[model samples]
Target: MGATMVEKILSSHALDRQLRAGDVVVASVDFAMVHDGRAGNALKMIEKMNAKALPFAHRAAFVVDHFSPPPNAEAANTHAAMRSFAAAHGARLYDVGSGICHQVLPEGGHFTCGDIVVGTDTHSTTYGAFNALGTGVEGTDLSAVLATGKAWFRVPETIRVELSGRLAPGVWAKDITLHMLRRLGAEGANYRALEYVGSAVEAMAIDDRMTLANHAAELGAKAAILEADAKTEAWLQAHGAAAPRPVRADADAHYAEVIGIDAGSLAPQVARPHHIDQAVSVAEAGTQRIDLALIGTCTNGRLDDLRQAAAVLRGKRIAPGVRMIVTPASRAIYLQALREGLIETLAQAGASVEPAGCGTCVGITGKLIAGDGEVIVSSANRNFKGRLGNPRAQIWIASSATVAASALTGVLTDPRGVAGGDWRVQ
Candidate 1:
């Protein structure tokens, strides 16, 4: 029988030995990424292991993004340690304002298609948008990879998700992913691979695809891969990455389950606080008041996402009582937004623009913490209790356009009801 994409990628990395679901193998990792949140532990593990040197230093990266600008002294110390480790190992290091690790790694041309990359962040699955087999691992596992350049894996079964029809106006990749979460639930695809295909997915831009893959972790996916085409090649080359080595699942590949979705019929989805799977249509969310409207993260902070939000807020102002913040995912994206006047547009709309980084998405920046009886609608991934620095503040997840529209009205307003420019992303 034919193999799924994950099976094929894992088998290729395992010396061309055919692999299937549940097969164990010690494969080589092409790249490893560690951020401030986990780099210290990884460095400590390496020291405890007493390894002579990091054999794969050149294939590794250290990024200080989660707590960029050293929100506190503790976070500053973590940055110091990351710098020391990067210099000692001769590895690449991205400092404050460089962006989230997931965006920084690829933008820095660290990995290419078909490469088996691992990171210390669950959102490492973001790299799967480039047709690479990227998954999350613990610091201990990352330490082993740095020391020996290898790691073990049990190939996961595949869940084939077929997306059909074009996305209606105001309905975008974020909404599609939120719908996936609502259908699959939090642990629905635990330790499994989700392979997305069909017309809707193909029509989506690379930025949109990143949003889909980045949030796959919320559905408990070990890896979420999208089929690559010319757009993938163009995006990699534009980012200075090496020529692509795209891979595809065979026509008759075995799948644990095959699910179909009609993108044309999907509406803007909102995931209630305390859980990502607690999703409902925007209309179903009712006219809930909001105090914060956040519009950036690794999940939806790309240039295109900013454009969509800008399209909604141009020549208008946010509600009188609402607070809006915009953060680009990377320095590159931030610069692009500036050149395109997206920054000024967002700022004029009463939104405070912060440096490009994880910012409030990880709660390390002390920006989006919620107070008692507060509600925040964010264009980010996770919304578990205390995810944004306070358990008392409720967080709702939605698309950037949705967040911007709600910000303009100070409630759970639908983007379709707001006057906006072209909502389609290139």
Candidate 2:
């Protein structure tokens, strides 16, 4: 193969050639990172293997994010298991009561760009935001990697995603990603390596870029990567990362398909039941209104996103009938929002603020009543069937701005049209 960017990167660290699909290639793993709930499962898998020694014992990492502080007894058990696992195996851990696994790893300078890393959670793909060939695998796969510093894989074909223009006002990286699933369907990107590019891409922040890549699995993608540049470098530097230069895809990189999107024309998008591709514009999905509004998650939980929500709800209150919920992605974001008074703004607007974790996004903690008593506008990833607490109550997806605006008006409205080039005290 002449090799695309992914191929080049893989080849540079390849242990073999002609590693086709269905063939297990035990390539070296540059890193292995795990999170709270997943680490317990990975620990069980490692025990099953009866492994005595680790290939990269010190390189193994365990991070506690989901229920780290213990929202309940089960969560407490999970946290204890992780800490015990870290201690027993001499594994590195980031249990400083800080951010989620994805946010903390890159911020803590664990894996660098071009490192082929894997984790036990799907969102491990978040590392791809920094141009690492990072992806998620089973706990068993991670256990094998822990034992051998290598894992099996069959090379997946590549799909190119080309963003055509600047996003319109109120449309964020999350909007484009949700809308992409709308067109491509959940299974469309299955078993393929995804490459995202173009101008709209350039305008996105590392957090948003991560949100897009992390959601690739929602479409069944093997892995998704954004072409890295100076912005990526700056983000890594700001987060204290000293990543190596990433290999950029050639201008004419080989892709199974080139998908184009004109982001400037895109409105806030939402996905309906059962599949991510069931997405529609907030206006089209408008009649299916909402009763709850939530902001923040690994997908849309950045400082800028909170500011957008605050901007939209600066002076207004959420509709009396609707209950808005806010959860930041990290303890750092919580402190930042607290200092900025975004938490106060949301609370003042009748919103309920939860801890800094992935609580409501995936219907994990803030699960709703399973019937039609509520509809929601959430800034979470994947609005699939039974995804947001209710298989009956409809859930719409949008940016923090649109979610906030919808929460205020109790109806879906184009926030860009409402706010224009600036945030207003609406």
lDDT of 1: 0.89
Model 2 lDDT per residue over 246-321, tens place: 8777665556888888888887777765556787887787465678888877777777778888887876788878
Q: Which segments of candidate 1 are over 4 A away from where they belong?
A: none
Q: Measured by TM-score, how close is model 1 to the native structure?
A: 0.98
Total backbone collisions, model 1: 0
lDDT for each residue of candidate 1 in 39-85, tens digit (9 for 90 to 100): 87888888888878788977899998888777788889989989988
Q: What is the C-alpha local distance difference test score of each model?
A: 0.89, 0.75
Score every model by TM-score.
0.98, 0.92
- Ten contiguous residues with the weakest lDDT in model 2: 417-426
RMSD of each: 1.1, 2.8
Off by more than 4 A, model 2:
15-24, 364-372, 420-426
The CA lDDT at 160 in model 1 is 95
